[model samples]
Target: MKPSETVLEIDLKALEHNYRYLASKVDDNVKKLAVIKAFAYGSDSVALAKKLESLGVDYFAVAYTQEGIDLRNGGITQPILVLHPQSTHFQEIIDQCLTPSIYSEFVLNHFIASAEANQQKNYPIHLKLNTGLNRLGFDPKEVPMIVEKLKQTSSIKVDGIFSHFAASEDVKEKEFTHHQMDTFKKVSDQLIENLGYRPLRHLCNTSGILNYPEAHLDMVRTGIGLYGYGNSKEVDQQLIPIGTLKTIISQIHNIKKGESVGYNRMFNASKDTKTATLPLGHADGINRIYGKQNTNVSIHGNLAPIIGNVCMDMIMVDITGIDCEEGDEVILFGKDKSAEVFAHNAGTISYELITSISQRVKRKIIP
Candidate 1:
């Protein structure tokens, strides 16, 4: 409630709804793992994870060791999987009872050594097989060796095996997704057979859970969808966005024709118009791309186009001929039809749009 400060409202009911919907997609054989990484994709991880925990999420997934530690520090009892494991934090990881996704032999060996040094026994670790993303995880050829290495470690436990799908919403490119699933399954089978371990096998993400029933092996990790941002237009239509970014219109002014606004004179009023500057800009996670073509806001339920380069703490929207005044409500992003719509206008994804929202914006859970 300070000037230039912003607030984001998260709907817990909508989050619960998204979870139940994704859960409905899972076959009876598959468990649900809620992806609470990146601060629940920038929407208060602790609050959201606590809610998902209460909603019966079978597991929790984070991108790093620190994220898992944050959840543990917050008193989360559900199993937390760190999708990306760092060798340096293996000690804290073991000390905190965090489950890490072991990808490379180097990191795996380090984890093994750390576990042994700490006198750990049967510590659970997830195996990530790199099917296609090429970003992280082990190659299929390395699975057998990984299995062999794991068998040599007494203090570590291979609790789960999984992979990430690059594309699942594009029904037209089902081949790519199918290939990823098939490859992951083959590697997982090889790993388990070679090591004689069957911990828990999982491969589907949010989009993957909706489109590929067979890929939901053992557990399904729901991230954006759990936060109510389905990747595709069709799937996105099925759910309500849970977060809404709002700020006050700090001031309004009339700019004559040819008058410039904001920095660099990037936007000029083509016609005499009324503009309102709201307390949100790139500094608050409204990316600069939303400045011209992608910017739009809701005022009195009517959408207005953004008129200038987004300043550090403010943006100008043409409210020409609209009823507006200072201290009025302005929806910068989230549940407002404008934000997601603007993302498409800027040729970007909803995850970038929502998660990019700055933490300075007070995030509150709506009961």
Candidate 2:
């Protein structure tokens, strides 16, 4: 396959390694749900899901129903959980055999009605309780009401119950995280007692898996961590980043002192400097804020500070004093230059940095 000027290289071996490493952290009975939402966080969902499914991933998750549809179309047979399914897509969800995380009374009832209308029997569904995040899911106090409604519905079946942690990654929020766990347990217990059976219970996300092993209930869902980041320096060292963004130097120029480079004169060379322009910019996931002293790219194992405003499809970097020339491989983020570090320099998180990579960028899987 021909390489594009800019490419997002996905190392399948590293991805599989990260999955095994994370799986090792959990109990044998606990299932693993690989979160492949946002196109596997912009790493090609179908390919990643296929690999994970083959590796014995018990389940997969996506943020939307369409993503689950895409997976189904891609020949993915593993169970898929739709995190935030809407009422409009309930029929299609059932048709595609995609389970939904029903959060609200309205969503639950609507889904039940849809199932009944379709003459569906024991259609799998997951209940999302709002322990503390408050983004989605039913409030803990609503468990009794939810239980009553489930009793009335014979069309849908509760396959699992879960909640999201707002700050499981922050040690400072330990108290809050525990409170969420406690609330989830209480709510899940009530539901189980009322239903006379227990559904699969899960609450831990990526950080929750590493920080709170005790909270890895019946199953754990991980998105960012599976892609080779542990949300912190200590754990990150144990994981290998599976995705590497690389590009080649398109052109090089020798800038004389006092000469400006790139748009709006954001960079004015004080001394003669060598500048290299890379075929990557904001449109390619390199945010404009990373330009003009904010971020640097790795070239020949050295730092090449990005100079001037990052353009839509190009960025100029100061390559002075570096042994580099046109066509040299430049690493935006990978082994030598961590995505976490690059995102930190741009005042964001690795999630945003990696997921922001444009779909137009070619993705090559390294077998």
The C-alpha lDDT values of all candidates are: 0.83, 0.92
The alpha-carbon deviation from the true structure for residue 312 of candidate 2, after best TM-score superposition, in angstroms, is 0.5
User: 242-297, model 2: which lDDT tens digit per residue?
Assistant: 89999999999999999999999989999999999999889988988898878899
lDDT, residue 75, model 1? 86
TM-scores of all candidate predictions against the true structure: 0.96, 0.98
Candidate 1 — which pairs collide? none
Q: Give per-candidate clash totals.
A: 0, 0
Output the lDDT of residue 213, model 2.
98
Question: Model 1, which residues run further than 4 Å from truth?
Answer: 1-5, 336-338
Q: What is the lDDT of residue 300 in candidate 2?
A: 81
